[model samples]
Target: MTQTLEQIASCISGYDPNALPVAQAQEFIARLVPKVQAVERVAIRSALGRVLARDLISGIDVPSHDNSAMDGFALRGMDLADDGPTLLAVAGTGLAGQQFTGPVPPGHCVRIMTGAVMPDGLDTVIPQEFTTLNAEGLVSVPAGIVRTGDNRRLRGEDLARGDAALHAGRLLRPADLGLLASLGQAEVAVFRRLRVAFFSTGDELRSIGEPLGEGEVYDSNRYTIWAMLTRLGVDVLDLGVVRDDPQALREAFTRAAACADAVITSGGVSVGEADHTKRIMAELGEVLFWKIAMRPGRPMAIGKICEPGNAGREAILFGLPGNPVAVMVTFYAFVRDALLAMSGATAEALPPLQAVCTTGLRKKAGRTEYQRGIVSRGPDGRWQVEITGSQGSGILRSMSQANGLVVLHHGQGHVAAGDLVEVLPFDGLT
Candidate 1:
């Protein structure tokens, strides 16, 4: 059974929309989103960045036969002399594909190249550089050089038959493709790509190449949202900008919810904004407006939006703030992981790195702050970070200049120079 927003909120120990903490908000969103159930089978080459639908099992053992790991001489371990050099006759040469069939004498060795099948009687290998070939048809093995079974690869060492090679919910990477090929798997079952519809609101917003008269600005939130969604491999539907009119906002919301699995809108979620986006959101579905305890991104709305006249069609809604920096900060903080979970992929949290702060920062004790920072290696070869100047929510240039965000927890207060803080780098965070 599908749970309503009230039912989900009732399960939490302390559910307060007015003063929600970052961790609590994350948990609430995680619980609210549902995974997409659609799956598709595609070739291994086309499965990159898609979540696996089931575990992939190996059908055959890797390295089916015992082989030589290096270019060396294959010999029996019992024939090595402990006190002095032992001489042996060269029986035959063993190439990679061509095996040496022999019934050699007791004191004999086979010259083998890398990846060549080991002879039936040989139990050890001495690297080619560790031995000397005399003028006669014999090789000299020095004492105390190698032990028994030194450089021979065992069969089924990498992957045994019927073993699980990859698990479900794994986002396939380039290396996973190679592993699939090694298992002789030509096609794989993966979750379908998530579909998301997003748009920005406000009468002051204008599209690119349009005239910005008096108090109008180009719509930047759409482009940024599109870029972020593209990095996650989701199919995006750009709905352009919706004006503050009630009818237009309603039509936009209804259309977006009808077509996409999730709907994202930026602007008009604040307390006293002159717009109908927030009203339309509430009128269309069960939405919860939040004032989360965080810096740069405080006002947000989250819930499920249902299309008008179509009760079966619904989409998850994430109403973000209007500022340029707040949209990005909130998206990375909340929406990214939520969408990954909805796509049926494992949403692994981005690990934070601890770095020394080079300057002091003033922070409140009750709110978590995400300060734009430039993290670098100090002169002492330790990780250190410095904040970018002017961290206002409207200033996006500081974010562009920063490579990371200094995450100060809700309980933390003032920070001085040389203090250690956690930073989330922008490397893998498109």
Candidate 2:
């Protein structure tokens, strides 16, 4: 028997994002979730933005040998005495990519450049400006300075052999590529990008570049969601726009389940005459929950799709609200964490900061609110957030001008101008 939305939510101890709290939502997803298993090996140069499948251990020392950290002269530390002028003959010059052969004799120094290997028997380096070159090819070092191992970079100072350079589940970045290259790692093993299917459903929504018919608007949610997914490093399978018909919704759901690891759609989940997504999802997969007690995104559906003739894999299904702002907020609030879990990322929540409210805000109790606000550093060097002009979910311009989401907890009524609030920065998707 298929479980209803509420029943399914109850079966999972912490499935309700609102009532169960944000921390619990994170814990439940982390505990009950398993990341995708497909892995791929690619060159380190091409592995940027890919999730690591295994730990990367260093095969050799980072510098490979002891090298000079400055352009100076290399000599024995005890050769110079305090307040005494010590003279030494210049033996050879060492530049990058070249090493000085043989050891430096007792009254001799080597002219070494930065990144050049320290010559044998040389224990210290003095800057070229500190030494005087005589016409007889002799170097003079001032006395009273007894420094050992100065301006020398030891072998493996950055990374040593057998040390783990990167751990599993880490997302590769540009700096990571340079680090891997320094360790001579030509290839890296990483998890393949998760394939996600997205679509927008509504009789009143039309794609861009199409003439608007009577009572129809452009399908802005699809493109918005696609951009967010692209920032998340997901391979998007765009299914185009689907009408609010049960048969069409069912067909799209089936195809999505067969091909995508997850499916996301905006609109057609609420209780209305043309909302057939809920009913069609019931026929295809079990609907987990709907109607969270949150502003702008109250009507949401979460489920797992079960398809015929395919090995059963839990395919996440999210039915976001129809409003443009609601769709954007809900995607960050709920879907982003789930997708990160699917990608094997442990930290799910967005980076948050504390900011002071610059204006009084009014709100009703018993429902959580995500108000768009502009955050900027005040003259006092403190962060101050102010709500935008409008708070309507249909106002897309408000989101455009906002820098972060000011969160109002449930049961909190109104906030004063100086009250502190938690702010989630809007630096784009993840």
Candidate 3:
């Protein structure tokens, strides 16, 4: 259902614009983002990493016939009565893709290979290893060895016919391809990939390969945002760095809103008299500047931007903080999931793994904090997390040295050494 901004905000109890809780901010974004309705039919191999537009129902039963699970003899359960070394005649052989025509006579068994259909009136199988065969073409089973219905695969055991095997809103994985193939699906429908436009906003930020002045720093946030967005399988449009001028920022926002489904801008969202980035964003659309109760990414903005001259040409906007580390932190914490939802992908949280902290840490309550961590196995073969030096928002090197983010909850307090904390590894993000 489509909800207005006010309608979505009313759902949250005691909603505060200035001091938004981390969870509340996430919830607000979830309720506001709209899913893409465009879909395309592609081969199973091309469907990997694409969001499934609809459930893929199984038209036929998997393993449509009852077959043997192993190379064994197929015999009636009554043939093993009393388990006293029963003797049976080896009737014939049943190989895969070949079924025996005539039914087995009483006390007669059929030699069945793996995946071969069971012969008529045969309900049990004794593995060849367990049975001894003589040169006279007779097989003998030990007493109380084989049970009834052992090593037989029933029809449609893996998947039933006319059942929904795969659900909608699922991001297809490698295993999903093999599963759809088992269902005899040649092509599957999936959502279209999202197009995202991103840019950095700051007069002091210089682009790479350009001459850097003594007071200017190279623009690294755009590059980092580009990499993160690309990993999510979206077509990214890098708009480079928009200067501090209001007119220049406005023109860039207009172009981005008209062409892309989502617009991501780093820097100029925070309070700064030298930049009019937030003011221009507010003029473009319904922009909500949020001081989210989260460390390293507190001052941010979220809203939708519409093209100046074109009606209904709008895009979701994320105005992230200027700091390199903060840009990444905010993107991973908020924007990543929102983009996934917008692209019709399922909303799945990255689960945090518990790891022992190697050093003491200071953190205040009432706000969540994400500290870059080096997660690795200690000498004791147990997972532990070590905080990178200088947890400053501008220290991008710390993020480079870390493989995980040590998450301190909104209500969490100071952590001591050897304390178990939640760490989200980068490899776990999908």
Global lDDT scores for all candidate models: 0.92, 0.81, 0.89
**lDDT per residue, candidate 3, 12-31, as tens digits?**
88789788889999999998
Instruction: Count clashes in each candidate, considering only residues at least 3 apart in sequence or on different chains.
Output: 0, 5, 0
Model 3 alpha-carbon drift over 4 Å, by segment: none
**Model 1 Cα shift for residue 423 (angstroms):** 1.2
Error of 2 at 124 (Å): 2.1
* Candidates ranked, most accurate by TM-score first: 1, 3, 2
Highest lDDT model number: 1
Determine the backbone clash count of candidate 1: 0
Estimate, for each residue in 28-99, the C-alpha lDDT of model 2 and write its tens digit: 444444588888899997898888889999999888889998898998887876678789898899999999
List the candidate 2 regions with Cα displacement exceeding 4 Å: 1-20, 83-87, 134-146, 271-275, 311-313, 363-367, 409-414, 418-420
Clashing pairs in 1: none
Query: Candidates ranked by lDDT, best first?
Result: 1, 3, 2
Give the number of the best model, judged by TM-score. Answer: 1
> Which prediction has more favorable lDDT, 2 or 3?
3
